[model samples]
Target: MAALQKKQSINCKVLVLGKSGVGKSYILLQYTAPPQEIVQMPKLTTVGVDYKYGTEKIEDTEVKMSIWDTAGQEKYRPIIQTYFKNSKAAILVFDLTDKQSLQDVRYWLREVKLQCGKDVAKILVGNKCDLPHEQPDQALIQEYCEEFQMEYIESSALQKINIQEIFVKLAKKIYQQHKASIPQNQLKQNSLPANEAQNQNSTSSNKQISLKNSKPKQKKENDGCC
Candidate 1:
């Protein structure tokens, strides 16, 4: 029989779902790599569902995440939902230049909720934010996010703007959720009994009084006189 390995870090699954050509793969690539290194890799694309592994430290604890970038085509929708099985967090990416892409995120959001349940943490990403000219309606996006109680942010994969912040934000939220899930009683460390501390103080005071009342033995000299 083989001995089981001890677990040191927590594992989290994060899903990136959006319409095709919304830079879902690009976001993951940029997040996992330096901007200068992956700058020329524009043609990178995920077919059905591509998995990327990355480790991030949330404060003192390390979190290993399997980031799943799902194909955004309608035909691949069924297959994409399967990857949502054990996802702890999800990012709904949309292209800033394409309004339809933003609107399509609603469908993906519904699918995520249905498949992954409502407890999964979700963040809305408006990618390609550095593009010139056209942009999604900020007010409308704010309304949607507020309505669904989802966090929203604008990111530019090419410019590397808010790229790292996205993951850090996600990691923080996931860590918080993990902490919240633990039983309250389990989170507290060992505590002394109600009277244990008070009793110790009382005992110390009695000891001091006993020492204070002790008198030098003069009885030995008096015994000789008896």
Candidate 2:
């Protein structure tokens, strides 16, 4: 079998938003991977916003992701919303074992749309999927995803289930969004060189005309000599 090759990466910003204790930071750490040692779970809650830099290879494109893990506590909600300013994609997580966490998904979804703008690509993540027997209806989650037009995935940051898949899929969405804009940008750039050349030529011609007009007329031999 041919070996899969990684592509050159481009920088992109992705935001992770959810209620506190939903393991949003863990999700980022799962991908970031701390030195292959036994790593203790972080007890500290995210303050305003936490950032981790990582890369994800989706097909031929490598996305150098600026993954922002935002504070999910209500007190920090306002502060967290500011991180949404530059986000191209978002992962809105909910704890699968906590019913209230599931409920809060709706509120978070609303905030993401309002603050990040309607065009931002989003995924609804049901985290802590390894927990046994959750009451939060899978059907309800599916329906919410369908209604919001967001991708839905179950992930366990602790067990590392579907962790990479979450980022890969979100990165794909971001990549597609960026890819869609390429043609218009290319069109603008392609048109620029010709337009610039035309302007330069016009300016040069105008300068020559102005010089000729400003010069004193040559004295004709048969006419009055200057």
Candidate 3:
């Protein structure tokens, strides 16, 4: 039997949702290495969803991720649901300095769960970690993550602290889930037809052998009569 071929890389979409000024766009820009001019935008509100692409390796497979940064205004919330419909993963961000932003995280999480369903992978992020005075209550954040069974991390896009690690961890988690979600039967189904064709060839060879043996017996009979 031929060996199974390696699985192809998968493309995944990850949507970043949070309240305004929570640094969602910055996180995406840092991960994707967008043009310097774009990254230099002065803290402006995102009018609509912005898209970026990033790649990370997990378990010997390259995972190409499309990161979407959705606008956080209340008016834009309903429209953002459309983008979440086919999302494979999400990053829920909140500002460490603002307690209200932390509370808004729950709202964003609910929207994601409602639109993307519970099976969609999620990660919680607390941005602006480099600012000592603005740090959020880590204990509270940890408790929230524990309750939801979500991975949590703190990062500062300006300082570049844990910026890359966040993407790496999210990629790893999605890769693991993607591998597990594919059923063994489906993989077998993909390979079964090739094996069946090989068996058919073997059967044809056996029929040729039987025809050769029968011909020898006929030749011997003809020789005796002669």
Candidate 4:
């Protein structure tokens, strides 16, 4: 039999949703380590959604992530909803420097729940934490997480702080969810067919050896009788 080729892996899609000017694009660019030009800050708004792909290794698994940085304008909300349907996870970013953006986290979370369902994995990110004077109260974010039962974290995309940890935590959570969703019985059933095939092949091999040995003995007996 010809050797089988290694399978190419599919990237996981993670939607980055938040209000305008909350550093969603920056976070993505920083994580991907794109060229300086691509990472350059853009003053213009994202019309629809922009995609950035990144790969990280967690233990033995290689996780490829396609991050969708969605446009936060009210007009583009509907367009962004389409991408959320297949999203495996989400990073709900809010500007720590802007109190209103912090308040708008709830609205983004609601949209995520509506599009991706309530059980979708999510991480609440408080961006611009380096400039604390302009940010909102950390207590308020904690209160919201307590009320909604969501994971919360603080980060500064400009300073490149907690950027890697945020995604690592996200990957870990998604991995756990994926593991839980798979049934143990289904896994056992899937392995059974391969095991049966191997056993059948072994039995057939043994029978062929027995037949060859019996043929030699019968030939010798016929010669002796003659």
Candidate 3: worst-modelled 10 consecutive residues by lDDT: 215-224
Estimate the TM-score for candidate 1: 0.76
Top model by lDDT, which number? 3
User: TM-score: which is higher, 1 or 2?
Assistant: 1
Model 1 lDDT tens row, 1-226? 3233233367999999899998989889888876567747668667789888888788656878899988988998777777788888888899988999988988988887888888777788999888874857888788768766678889998777898888878877787788788778644421234365456557999999999999987755565584
Clash total of candidate 3: 0
Order the candidates by lDDT, highest first — what do you get?
Answer: 3, 1, 2, 4
What is the lDDT of every predicted structure here?
0.81, 0.80, 0.81, 0.77
Give per-candidate clash totals.
0, 0, 0, 1
Model 2 alpha-carbon drift over 4 Å, by segment: 1-9, 184-226
How would you encode candidate 4's per-residue C-alpha lDDT over 109-174 as one tens digit per residue? Answer: 777777777766678898888884554677878876776556888888788899988898888777
lDDT of 2 by residue, 1-226 (tens): 3223323456878888888999998888888876475377666578898888887777557888888988888999877777777777888899987788888888877877887777777888989888895567878788778877789888998888999899888888877776776798564543355556567668999999999889688966866555
Candidate scoring better on TM-score of 2 and 3: 3
> Could you say which candidate leads in TM-score?
1
Q: Tell me the TM-score of model 2.
A: 0.73
Question: After best superposition, candidate 2 residue 208: deviation in angstroms?
Answer: 24
The local lDDT score (0 to 100) that residue 118 gets in candidate 4 is 71
Is candidate 1 or 2 superior in lDDT?
Answer: 1
The TM-scores of all predictions, comma-separated, are 0.76, 0.73, 0.76, 0.73
Q: What overall lDDT, based on C-alpha atoms, would model 1 receive against the true structure?
A: 0.81
Write down the lDDT that model 4 would get.
0.77
